[model samples]
Target: MKQTIRLEQFERADIRSALAKMNRGIERESLRITSEGQLATTMHPAALGATLTHPLITTDYAEALMEFITPVSTSITTTLAQLRDVHRFTYQHIGDEYLWPLSMPCYLNATSDIRLAQFGKSHVGRMKTVYRQGLTHRYGAVMQTISGVHFNWSVSDELWPLLAAEEGRENNADYRSERYFGLIRNFKRWAWVIPYLFGASPVLCKSFLKHSSADLDFHELSSGMVYVPHSTSLRMSDLGYTNKEQAALKITYNSLDDYVDGLRRAVFTRSEQFADIGVQTGDKWQQLNANILQIENEFYSPIRPKRVADSGETPTQALERGGIQYIEVRALDVNPFSEVGITAEQMRFLDLFLLFCLFTESPELSIECQQATEKNVNKVVLRGREPGLTLMDEAGEYSVQERLAHLFAEMAKIADVLEAESSAYHRALQSFAPAISNPDATFSAKLLRMYEEASKIFQHVGMRFAVEYRDRLKNSGYEFYTEADFQKMAAQSLAEQAEIEAQDKGSFGDFLAAYFEQALDKKKRA
Candidate 1:
C-alpha cells in the first residue's frame, strides 16, 4: 500500500539550518568506525591522503536519528541556480534506462555495439591502467569519494532475536529476505509522497536511469531516502520551518549544463540580487561529486549482470550468474551551496570526463574490472588502502602512474579544442583540466598522502544540520515538526494506501484492523 506524509504550515529556513548541522553528525558517527588509536581521517586513500583507516558500522544508528527529523515541500518554490552557461548543454541523461516498461540499450547498443566494443577491447587493458593512474594522480585513493547519499533501513530491539538467529544461519538469505526490499517496495506503490505531504503543514523520494536484464532496481538502492527540505547558504528559507523536513524537486533540464545551472540556483546561490536575503549556500558540489561517482552502481560497469546461459557450477556460481542487477546513483547529498548538489565549474569538467567514458567504452565486461570496481567502492567507503589497486577501463590495465599520464594528455586535447571553439563550458572545463591533469599534485593527492586530516566529528555535522534547519524553519517561519505531525500524515497516507491496496479485494481498513487485532492477540498469548 502507498503511504504519504504531509508537512503543513512548515517554514523552510529551519529545515535548512538543521540539515547544515547534520554535516557534523555524519562526521561524528563515522568516528566509531575508525581505529580508536588512529587520529587520521577514517576516509583512507591509496596514499595516506585519499584513504584513511575506519571501522565497520550499520546504518541503523543513522536511520534512528533521521526518524526524528522533519520534511518539507520543494516543487512549489526553490529557485535553483542558473549560473554562466556552458558549451554542449545537456540535462538528465537521455537513455533507454527507465524504471518500468524496461528501457534497455538501443541505438547506444542493445547487446553491444561492435564498433564501440572494438574501440573498447583495443583499449580495455590500457584503459584499466589509466583509470588507476588517473585516480591516484588526482586523489591518491583508488576509490574517489564516499558519497553523502544514503538509503534508509530500520532494525529495532524487537528484531534483535531474528538478527541473532540469522547470523547463525549458513547463508544470509533469511536476513536478506527480511530487510532488503522493504523500502523499495514502498516506493513502487507511492511516489507523490515526496512534495504534497512536505510543507509547514505536512512533509517528503529514487529511480534508476538504466534497465539491466536482471539487476537491482532503483528503489532497492535508496529506499530510506525521503524528501528532506533543501536549503542552501543562498536562501535559508527552509530553515524557517520548525520541523526537520527535507524535500526534492523533479525538474526538467535540457542538458548537463542546464542541470549544473539548476543546482547553482537551487542550492548554491550567493548573488547580489538576493544580497538582502541571508542565505548560506556552501561549496558542496565538490563533495557531492566525490560522493556520486562512487555510488554502488552508477558510473562504473565492470561486469554485466544478466541471465546468461546458466552454466552448472558450485553453489555460489548459480547465485552470482543468476543474480542480475546493476548499481544505481542515489544517496546524493544536497549541497546547500548548489541547487542539485554540484557546481558549474565542477559540472563542466565532469561532463567532458564522463563523456570520455562513453567514447572509449570497453568490449568485454571483464570480471577483473568488476572486481576492481568493487574494490574501488570498498576502498573509498572504508578508506582506499589497497596499494597499487587498478581502475577498470579500456586499453588494458596500467599502473596508477601510467593511466593518469594518458588521461592528463587526453584532457589537455579536449581542453584545447574547447578553448579554440570558444565554448563557455569548454573554457570552464579547460581551466580545471590543468589542475586535474596533474592530480598527482592536487589536494586530492594530499588527502591520500596524509592520514586523518579532517575530524570525524565534522562529517556528522551534515545530518544534524539537516534536523536543525528543519526545526528553525518550523519555529521561526511557517513550518512545523513533531512526531505528532508525522503520525497524522502517516495515518492519512496509510489509510489512502490501504484503500488502494484493497481494490478488487477486501477493505483496507478491515485488513489493518485485523492485522492489529491479531498482533494484540499474539501479544496477549505471549
Candidate 2:
C-alpha cells in the first residue's frame, strides 16, 4: 500500500501556515559532579525539590546525573528560555558541583563508585530506582551515565486533520497514528544527517574504555585523551548507549500496533543473561525483573512515539488510550558549543527537517531496510565527514555530500512553507552545507581542533565550559521563571512526593505481582 502522500500533494495542501503553529519541548540531561570532575557523592540537592515529583528537575540513572525538562512551548524562544531558567535555578542550588558540559562523561574511577539514584520509600519511587539498577546490570554504569538531549515535538492540532485528508483518510486516531508511523519511518531513514551536523562527542577519557570492548583504532593523545580520527559522536556509536539483545528485537515501525506489541513482548520476555544477575541479591533488590525490558521506556530507540501517561498508567497503556501525542527525537548529542546544550537555530532546523519528514513519501520499513538504516547511522556516527564516503539507499550508494545536498534542497521548500522566522531555518541549513563540503567545519571536527589548539584534555575543556556557563547563568538571571516561582514549585513537589509515599499501603512484593499480572492480562487482550 502507498504509505505517504507525494510532496506535490503537500504543496497543494498549503501546510505552510499550519506548520508555523507546532509545539515543542526539550529534555536535556547532564551529570552534576564535583569541581575535580568526579561524580558527585552528595544527594540530589534539596533546594532543587523532590526528584520524584519535580516537574523540571529529576535524576536519570545515577543520583549525580541530572535531567532538566521544559514544559511544552509553541516557540523555540520560550522553550530555550525555560531551559535556561531551569539551568540557572539548578546552578544556584547545587553547592560546589558543576554540570558536566559535554555529552560524554568526565573522569570516572569504577562502576561501583557511581551511586544509583535514590527515591523516597514509596513503591513507585523504588520501582524507578530498580529499573535503573536493571539498566546498570544489563549495560554498564558508564554507558548509563552518558547523557544527551531529547527534543519532543508535535505539529499543531489543526495540521493533523488536514494531513489526514490529503492522504484520503479519515481524521481519526488511527489515521493520526498511521501518519505518525510514517513520520517515524522517514525520520529513521534521514536521521544520519543529525549526527553529521550536530554531533559533538568526538573524544573521550580513556577511563570510559575500561568497561567497553570497542576495538576501534583509537589514537591515544597526551593527558589520557583517546579518539578515532574523523569520528562524529562516539556517544551514539556502539561505544555509547546500545544493546546487542535489542538488535534481535527488530521492532517494526510499520504500525502503532506492531510497535507496541514488540515492546510488550520485550517487557514480558525473560533474558537468560539477566537471569544470572538475579532479581534479588539477598535482602537488596538487584533489579525490578529478569525480563529483557523492565518497562516500555527500556526500549532504547533514536526516536519514540510518546503520549503523556495519566496517573497509574504505563507508557504502553497511555499510547493505547490516546495515540502518539508527540515524537521524541533522541539522536541529538549535547552541543557543547552552546551554553544551554542546544541552540534556537538548531531547534528551527529540526522543525524544518521534521516537517520535511512528515510531507515526504515514506516507504514501509522492512528488515533489510532497517539494517541499511543502522549502517547509514553508524557511518555518520563513526566517520561522517570523511571525504568521498558513501551511504547506501534503495536507489543505490550515494556520496554523503550529494545526499545531504538533496535533503537540504527539499528542506529549503519546507523552510519556505514555514511562516515565522523562516530565515532561521534557512540559516541552519546553510550552516550544515559547509560541513559537508569541508569536514573540518563539522562540530566534531571543530571540537577536535579546539582540543588540539587549547592543548588541554576533554575534562579540562568541559570544566572550563562548566564554570563559564555557571557564571553566565549567574549574571543573566532567569528568563521564563522567577526565583519565587521556583521555590513555590519546589515546596509543592516535596509535599506531593511525601503524599505519594504516605499513600503507599501495599508491600513491594504485592505491587510487583499486581503490575506484572496487569501487564500479562493486557497482553492477552491485545
Candidate 3:
C-alpha cells in the first residue's frame, strides 16, 4: 500500500549536503488597517512601486491587502532576514496604516469597501484586474480579503538523483516530477497537521459573517466576537478559504501530465453559474470569461506544484515545458504572535516535514480517497483541539494524536540527517511534541487563550497586535536591505511598468482572445 525510502540506504554525505541546500521563499500577506482598526481605502502605496512589477512588495485581491515576497534563499535565517527587510521597508511608506497581524481581515462595514488591486494600462495589467473581477463575481470580495502566508520551497537538485538511484529509476526530468508528485500526494494525506499546529484564527469579527448564513456553531463572546471553542483556523474552514464549486473538479496528483490536464480542463470548462453573471455587463468587463476558473491560479488548494513561468507562459504551460520546479504551501495562517508573521523555527519545521513527505510512501489517491482527505482536513480546520478526535487514513480510522505521533517519529530520522548542517533542525522538530499531548500548547489554542484572558473584543485584540508589530517593524533596523536598495527597486519596478505599457499592442479584447487561444498540448506549437 506504500513505499517508503530507507534513510540508511542513502550516504550520510548525500543526506547532509542535499537536505541542507533546499531553497525557501516566503509570501506574507497582510491587510492594511487604519489606526482606528478599520480597513484602509488608500490605493497601493506609490513608494512600494507598481503592483504589476514590484519584485518584493505588492497587493493581493484588495489594494489594502499587502503582500511581501522574499527572494529564494538556501538558509532559513537568510530568508527570514529578507522578509524582515521587506516588512521594515513597507512600514516606512505605509504612513499610519498598520499591517493587520491576523489571517482574517479586520471588520468591514460593507463588501463594496474592498477594492480590487489595480495595475497600469498594459494588456497584461488589465488581464490581472479582470481575472480578479471574475473572482469577485464568482465569490464575494470579503472572501478574497482574508490573507495568509504562502511558503515556496524546492528540494535540492542533487537530492533527486540520490533518490532516483535508490528507487532504481533514471535521474531525469520525468523522474524528478514523479517524485515531486509523490510528495504532493503524501502532503495531502497529512495536510491537516499544518492547520492544527500553526492555525491562529479561531475567533472572527462578528461582521465577517453578517451577510451570509454559514452553518457553523459559534460561541458569541460579545456582539462583536464569535468563535468556535475548539477550532484552530477558521480561515481554512468552510467560512474562510474553502470553495464549494472548485471541489467538483477533482484534480489528482497521480502524475505531472494528469495534474496539468486537470488544471487546463478547469480553465477551459464553462460554468453556468458564472455564465449567468456574464463576462461583459454594460461595457464593464465583469469577468475574463464564463469558465470555472479564469486561469489556473483560481483553483485554490492547500498546496500546488509550481514553476517560474516565463512572460506569456501560463502555469500549466511552464509545467509542460519543464515539469514542477518547486512547490507552494498555502495552508499556513499568518502567525499573529510574530512580528513578520512567521518564525525561523517554523521555517525549519516546514523543511523537515516536507522532506518526510518526499521520502514517505504515497499511494495514488482515488476519488474516494480524495474526498476522505478533504473530510480529514475539514475536521482539523473546525475542531482540531477536540480531545480524542479521530481521522481517516488508508489504514482505516486513527486518532489525530496517534497519526501525529507516527508522522513525527518518521520525521525524526530526517531531522537527524539534516542535523549535519544545523542542530536547529532537530530542535524545530522536537518543539511541537508538547502540543501533541496538550492541545492548549498549540498556537491556535494559545492565541485563543490570550484573547480570552485579555477581556477585550476580538477586533481590539487584533488591532493591538497590529499596532505592536507596526511599531516594532518601524523601530527595528532592516536585516538584509538598506533604504537605498528598496528605493532603487521601487524606481526600477516603476520603470518596468512604464516600458510594458509603452510596448503594448492591440486592443485588450484581442489580447484576451489570443491568450485563450494558446494550445494545451504537450509541446508548444511554432
Query: Which candidate leads in TM-score?
Result: 3
TM-score of each: 0.28, 0.96, 0.97
How well is each residue in 303-393 modelled by candidate 3, as lDDT tens digits?
Answer: 9999898778888888888888999999999999898899988898898789888877787998789889889989998989999998987
Residue 193, model 3: lDDT of 92
RMSD of each: 27.7, 2.4, 1.9
Instruction: List ranges where model 2 is wrong by over 4 Å.
Output: 1-14, 456-459, 521-526
lDDT of 1 by residue, 368-464 (tens): 5333433333232221112453433334544433444455455444444333232654565555444323433332233222212222322322233
lDDT of 1: 0.24
Q: How many clashing residue pairs are found in candidate 1? A: 164
CA lDDT of each prediction against the hidden true structure: 0.24, 0.85, 0.85
Q: Would you list the clashing residue pairs of candidate 3? A: none
Residue-level lDDT for 486 in candidate 2: 94
List the lowest-lDDT window of 10 residues for candidate 3: 517-526
Give per-residue lDDT, candidate 2, residue 449.
75
